[model samples]
Target: MADFKLTYATMFNPPEELHAGFDKAVEKLKKNMGQEYTMLIDGKEVKADEKFDDHSPVNTDWVLAKMQKGNSKHAQDALTAARKAFPMWSHTPWQKRVELLRKAASLIEERIFDLGAAMALEVGKNRMESLGDVQETADLIYYSCYQMEKNDGYIVEMGKDPLVGYDARNVSVLRPYGVWLVVSPFNFPFALTGGPAGAALVAGNTLVIKPATDTAWIVRLLVDCFRDAGIPDGVVNFVTGPGSTLGQALVDSSEVDGVTFTGSFDVGMKMFQDFGKRNYVRPIILELGGKNPVVVSKNADLERATIGIIRSAFGLQGQKCSAASRVLVEDSVYDDLVGRLKETASKLVIGDPTDRNTYNGPVVNKSSYNDFKDFCEEINQGGGKFLVGGNVKTGGMFDKGYYCESTFVVDLPFSHRLWKHEMFLPITTIGRVKNMDEAMSIANDVNYGLTAGFYGSPEETEWFFDKIEAGVTYANRPQGATTGAWPGFQPFGGWKGSGSSGKNAGGHYYLPLYMHEQIRTLVK
Candidate 1:
C-alpha cells in the first residue's frame, strides 16, 4: 500500500492489503463489543447516574457499547475544566501546541483500522468510507499543524512607525479565544469532532467536545487518542447525553468563548440565536445541512454524469451534508441519463456495511428509518414517480436493523417542499430542464449553498462555476458529484445558509477562525 494514497476519490480501488487489514480489525472489534464506556473530563473518568446502550444500525441485536447519559451538570463540569485550563493552555507556545496536535494526528492514523471498523458498525458507513473518515480526520489535523508551521505561528513583524527621536516597533499575533465548545453530529463523527478540536487546541484554546447521542462511542475512542497523545489535563474534555440538557447547557454557558457546531439548519440557527443573547458576540461556526444539486448539461458525458450522480446520491445512504439530493438535467439527454442512473443504482449491494461486497448500508437509526418512509409516502401522494427505489428493506437480516432502499424520484413539481427540504436519507430527486439557464436557476433557488456538481463542455462548466451559489463545486468527476471532499485537496464547507463563517474547513483559512488578532506596539 506504500505506492498508493488513500482519499475519498481514491478509495474506490484500494489495494488488497487494505481489505485484509480491515477484515482483521473487524474481527478484533467484534470480541470487544458491548463494553461499558465512560466520559473523559479533566483527565478523569466520570460516570453518570444513568447509562444508555448503543446499538448498531447494521444489526440492532448487537449492542455496541454502554455510554454515560450525562446531564447539565456534566456539561458545566466539562466547560469549567476547560475554562480553568485556558490560562496555561492559551499561554503555551504555538510551536509546542502544533507538536502535540501532530502527535494526536499520528495516533489517529495508527488506530485507523480499529476506529474505522467501529465507525462502520456504529455509523452504518461502508468499510472504505469509514476508513476514509478516520484518515481524513488525521489529515485535517495534519493540515492545521502544517498551516501553523507555515505561517510561523501566526506571528508577523509589521512595519514600524517612525517617531521623532524614538524607535518604534510593531508586531501582530493571532491569539486563541478562551474555552471552546465542539458539538459534533452523528455522520463523520470522528473527522468533524477531531478537526475542530485540533484547530481550537492548536490555536491555544482549551476544549469541551460533545458527540451526537447516536454516535458517542466512536467519539469516545477519538477523545482517547488526544488524551493518549499527552494533551494536558483539563485542556480537552468530553461529555455525552441529550442535546436539550447537556448540549444546551454548554451553549448557554457564559464561560464558553466560542463554539463550532455541525448539524441541521434549524437547530444550528436556534443555537446561534441563543448564543447571541450573550453580552458580547462570540464566534459560532456552523455547517448546517444542505440541499445540494447536480446540473448536467445537454453536451455532457452521460456515462460520467450518471456514475457521479449515483455515487453521490446513494453513498452512505445519502446521509452526507454534501450529498447530491437533487439532479437537474438538460431535456436533450435527461431520459438517457436517468435510465443509466437507475440501472447503476439498482445494482448497488445493500446489507451489513461491514461486508466486503456491500456498497450501501442502513440508515443511521430508527428515527431516520421512519422519516424515510414518511418522505416516500409524501412523494407518492404528490404525484412523483420512483425511478429506482422508494421502499424500506425488511425481512431477513434487515428486520433487525434500520434499513432503507436507495430512492430516486422524478416529475414532482418544482414547488414541492421536498425539493428544498433536506431529507438526509437515501433519497434523491431528479428533474428535467429546458436549458442550462433553467437548470442553474432551479439549482440556485434553494437556501443551501453547500456543494454543487456540474457536467458539461468547457464553456458551460465555466458558466456553472461562475453562477453556482455553492462553496464547493465540482465538474465532470466520476468519483462523486457533490461529495468526496478531502483535506488539503478539497477543503469542505458551505456558503450562504449552509455555513456561518464563510470559511472552509481543513484549509488555509480555517485555523484563524479559532483565534483573534492582537497587535503589539512598542516605542522607546
Candidate 2:
C-alpha cells in the first residue's frame, strides 16, 4: 500500500522469509483437502445435489477439494443476484470501487503463498509458475485500478456549443453494462478470473464468475480475497461445474449484459455467435487458444534461442494459450538450433509441482496426458522423428500423475495438421525455412494470431515486427519467446481467431470494454 507498486514473482531469488511461509501454507492446505466448497450465490452459500472432486494433476488420488456441480438453475440464480445488486453497485463512486480493488489486491498479496499452493495442486504448475500466477492476479487488479484513476474515472467533458440563445454543456460518461459473466479456463485460474472480474467491477459492473472444472478450488480461494476486501456478496458470485452445462447456461442467459471468456477456440466462437442472437448487441471479450510460433534466424544466438524456445514451449506443460508450439529455423542454422534445443529440452526437470526444483509438471488432467501421448505417436508414425524426447516417463513420480517428457519433433511436413493445429501439450514442432521471409510465412500461416517470438539481426527483427500478424510479439527475449507476458508490462491477449475483442487485458482498452458510452447535453 506504501507507494503502490506491483512487482512480479521472483522465482530465482524468492525471499528467504517467505520460503518458510509458503511451506507452512502448502501443508495447511493439504490438510484441508477434500472439504466441500459451495457456490457463492447472492451472498449466500448454496449446495447442489450433485458434487465433483478436484484432484491434483500430479496425483489423482490427492483430492484437493469437493465442489458443488452448478447447473442451469444455479446459473440463473447467480445472474438474478447480480442483476439485483447492479443498481447500487453501478452507482457506487469510482473512487470507492478503486479503493475496494486495491484492498482486494493487497489481501491477495497477504495470502499469496496459500493461493499459490492451491494453484499448484489444481493446475499442476510448479511453485514458481503457481506463485507468479497468483501475484499476477493481484497485479492485474492493481493495474485495472490504476487505469480507472488515470482516465479520471472514464468521465470526459466535451466542448460547449455556442449559439445566440442556446447554452449547451456536453459531456461523455462511460457507464457500466448491467451484469457480466466471467468464464475462466483451467490454466491461470486466478489471473484470468481476477483480471476480467476486476476490470468489470472497477467499471461499475456486477459479476458472476465460473471457473473451469479443473480449477474450482483455486477460484474459491480467490473469491475469498474479494469477499474479504468488502465486495458486497451479491456483487461478485462464484460457481463451479462443467462448461457444457453451467458455462453454456451463463452465456445463453439474456440477463447477462456482457461476457468475458478464456478457453478453446471452438467454445469461444460459439459463445460469440450466441451472444449475437440476443435482442440487443452485447460485448464479448474472449482470449482463445493459440498455435503460436517462434522464428529463429541464421543470425540468431543459438543458445539464447534454444533456451527461450524450450522454456516457452514447455512451460506449464505447454498448457498456456500463448505457448510457443511451432518453431521455424532459417535453413543455414536450422540443424544447429534444433540440436541445441533437443539437448537442452532433454535436461529439463519434470516431477511434482510442489517441488521447488521441478521445472516441468504434470499436464492439467488425464485427458491432456492422453493428448500428449497420441500426438507424439501420430507424429512419429507419420514419419516425423523425435529430436530428443518422445516417451512418457512412468513408474515413480509419474505413476499416478499425468506426466510426459518435453517432446521435440522434426522432419515433419509444414502442411501437416499437427503443425497447423494447437496441441496444448508439452509438444513443439520444428521446421526449416529458406530465410526470414519463409520463417515469417510459416509463423503467420496458422489460424491463430496470439503471441509470437523472434531472434534475428536488427533488420530482420524490424522486418519480423512489421510483418508478424500476431497481437503480441517479442524479439530476442530470453525470459520467454512466445510466452511470459506480465500484466502492465505486457497486456496479454490474442488476435484473429485467437481472441474475440481486439483489446488486450492490463492495457488501456480493457476497462473500457466493460463500459458503455453515454453522451449528455444540457441546455441552460
Identify the leading candidate in terms of lDDT.
1
Instruction: Name the lDDT value of residue 426 in candidate 1.
Output: 94
Positional deviation of residue 429's Cα in model 1 after best superposition, in angstroms: 0.5
Give model 2 RMSD, 1 decimal.
1.8
Q: What value of lDDT does candidate 2 attain over all alpha carbons? A: 0.89
- Give candidate 1's TM-score: 0.99
When superposed on Cα atoms, how far off is each prediction in RMSD?
0.7, 1.8
Tens digits of lDDT, candidate 2, 268-294 = 888899889999899999899899999
At residue 372, give the lDDT of candidate 1: 98
**lDDT values for all models:** 0.95, 0.89
* Model 2 spans > 4 angstroms off: 1-10
Worst 10 residues of 2 by lDDT: 1-10
lDDT of 1 by residue, 66-183 (tens): 9999999999899889989999999988889888999999999999999999999999999999999999999999999999999999999999787889989889999999999999
TM per candidate comes to 0.99, 0.97
